[model samples]
Target: MHQERLTKLRNASPAVLPSLLQCDFGDLRSEVERLQAAGIRALHLDVMDGHFVPNLTYGMPIVAGLRKLTDLPLDVHLMISDPAAYVDDFAAAGADMLTFHIEAVPEPAQLIQQIHSHGIVAGVALNPQTPMEALSGCLDQVDAVLVMSVNAGFGGQAFDPEAVQRLQQLRQSHPELLLEVDGGIKPETIGPCHQAGCDLFVVGSAIFGQDDYAAAVRQLRDAL
Candidate 1:
């Protein structure tokens, strides 16, 4: 697919991405359909293993189940110990974008190439302590960079506003990279990240836990 396809897929103002995360598997189809109607073009799936992030989330069964939900693109974050071990599994599970922690595998660039070989976009994530300098040479190899502004194991944590400056420096160093901020994103916090050059912002509890999901999505979109 063309790179521009991502920009054209959603109707949100400012052309920013609002990726829904920590979603209820029971109501996924309806939730996805509602997001589609609400002008969302992508969903962020947080995958974790007990060792990597102190939490165990979903695997093949749930990922496969979600593949049936919608046509909107899926952004799969692998918070596992050995992400490279399951690259093809995630591709087979229908992930449009496969993201893994930069600290996971021995070779970040090669695994990214492996994902792209599967014909899916590849992404690398940075934990609260992982520096962008670690991604130095491979910056061009990954399609996106996910910066976890809050610790990964929990939700509803406060946004680390300092991430805005940290991400800005990284964005300045690699302007073409697709920057995504995951964790504690609300209408108030996202604008600062946007100004700091984040292209996509991931929000979980702020959207799904709200009484009105679509309205929340719209508010985030408008705020961006």
Candidate 2:
């Protein structure tokens, strides 16, 4: 099942995944409906623990809630201190993919195996300041790698030009890996990231902050 979903995502290469963190949680179902109508292929969920990133976002309940709302792939980003402990919980909550911060894990390969054990795609994420060398041992083992364009915790930060370099390096080294870019992914910055080698763009404010979600998505796609 997980492989099928991953294949579906790969088929829609360079897909736009609207971040739910910026959506109207008061009316989440409608927000999801709007995104689906706007032609989104997946949804990105940011789960942050206060200790790891100085911010607290939603947890399993929200994941489950979104699971109940739509069948679109749930790409859950775990920005926490200990993601291995929550692997089963998030997978049970219906996450199709679970990406944990490489900086937070001592045994990234083990954690990646743990996430895969749950029958879901596992990804490793690196913060803007983290060197690409940090992912050396586990790069080829995981299904995806999320290159943070900005710091992890916040929602509306500026895109870091360094992230494009990181994406390029990863693409050059591992051409088959799914490269995802998150944070500061508006029309102006997204094109360069895509050119550099990003298979998935996790956009937040660019779509949610707009009056017309469909138009916002179309504009971003046009930029790509």
Candidate 3:
């Protein structure tokens, strides 16, 4: 059933920035509106903490506020140490897709189960240093796998060349699973990622920090 749902999202209307990362919390409503107007179908929310990733991002208030900004789907990625502790909060905050790192939580499979219980798509994120094999026995419950190309915590980092081969390996092992690529996902790198079987592309500073947000989305989409 989860697989079927993911397939539906993949086949949705093609447009600019299928995955638009909203890192700048400044004027949350305005930014969300601009992203939606720019033809971004899905919004990627990066949740961080000073612990796991050396960064501190907003929590429930931002999520609650952004919920009213646009009707577009929200993709929440938790880069915190204790992911399960905030599962219910994020779920109640209106996240359509919740992805927590596989290496952070104590019981990842159980966390996925709890996320599912909340009626949202549950996904797992693997850091740049983490092996792809870490997702081994827990693939079935996951709706997606977020492979971090840069060390998490901040944006605008270089896209790792080694990630390409690793992405290919993930594609080979899990054809049914939706693979997502995050961190430093610029226009030129998108093609190879798609070719390597990454269905979802999460771009943060590439779009948010641009002169024209809408144009950035178009450039990323057209390049891919």
Candidate 4:
């Protein structure tokens, strides 16, 4: 199941995954419909525990709700301290790809295998300041690597220039890895990241903040 989802994601490479964090929850179904109608390949959902990132976001309920809403792949990001504890819950909640922070887990290999056992794509994420070497042990084991261009706690933060360099290094070293960039991805900043070899972009405010979602997505695609 994970292999099939990974193939779908690869086919949609250089795609923008609109973050649900910036969407209007009251009209979530409509927001998702608009994005799908606009041709988004996937959705990015951030699950944050208050302790891990100093901010609390939605969990399984939201993921389960989204599963019923669209067939688009749900790229669930676990910004929590103990992602190992909830892998089963998120998998059952309908996450197609589960990405966890490397800083949060002491032994990522076990967690990666644990996630795969549930038949969902597993990914490792690196914060802005975390060096590439930190992922040396398990880089080849996961399906994707999410490069957080800003701090993980919040949305609408500025894109860190250092992330581009990190993307370049990863692209050069691990040519086949699925490289995703999150945070501050807008029309202007997205171009550079794409050039730097980012395959998937996690965009929040740039898509949802606009009145017309299609035009906003078009602008970002054009910028790419």
Q: After superposition, how far is residue 116 of candidate 3 from its true place, in Å?
A: 0.3
**TM-score of model 1 (CA atoms):** 0.90
| Cα error of candidate 1 at position 191, Å | 0.3
Instruction: For residues 60-148, write the lDDT of model 1, one tens digit per residue.
Output: 76667778877667778888989889988888888877888877763677787788788787778877877667777678788778888
Q: What is the C-alpha lDDT of each candidate?
A: 0.75, 0.91, 0.76, 0.92
Q: Candidate 2: where is the Cα deviation over 4 Å?
A: none
Residue 62 displacement in candidate 1 (angstroms): 2.3
Judged by whole-model lDDT over C-alpha atoms, candidate 3 comes out at 0.76
lDDT of 4 by residue, 110-217 (tens): 999999998898899999988778999888899899999999997557789999999999999999899999988899899999999999999988898899989999
Which segments of candidate 4 are over 4 A away from where they belong? none
lDDT of 4 at 47: 92
Best by lDDT: 4
TM-score of 4: 0.98
Per-residue lDDT over 20-42 for candidate 2, one digit per residue giving the tens place of the 0 to 100 score: 88888899989999999999989
Instruction: Compose the digit string of candidate 3's lDDT tens values, residues 1-224.
Output: 44444555566423234333355556666777777778787777788888998888777777777788766667788989998899899888988778898888635778888888877888888878887778886887788888889888866578897777877988898877777888778888887888787878888767877878889988888877
Instruction: Output the lDDT of residue 3, model 1.
Output: 51
**Lowest summed-lDDT stretch of 10 residues in model 4?**
154-163
Number of clashing residue pairs, candidate 1: 0
Ranking by TM-score: 4, 2, 3, 1
Candidate 3: worst-modelled 10 consecutive residues by lDDT: 12-21
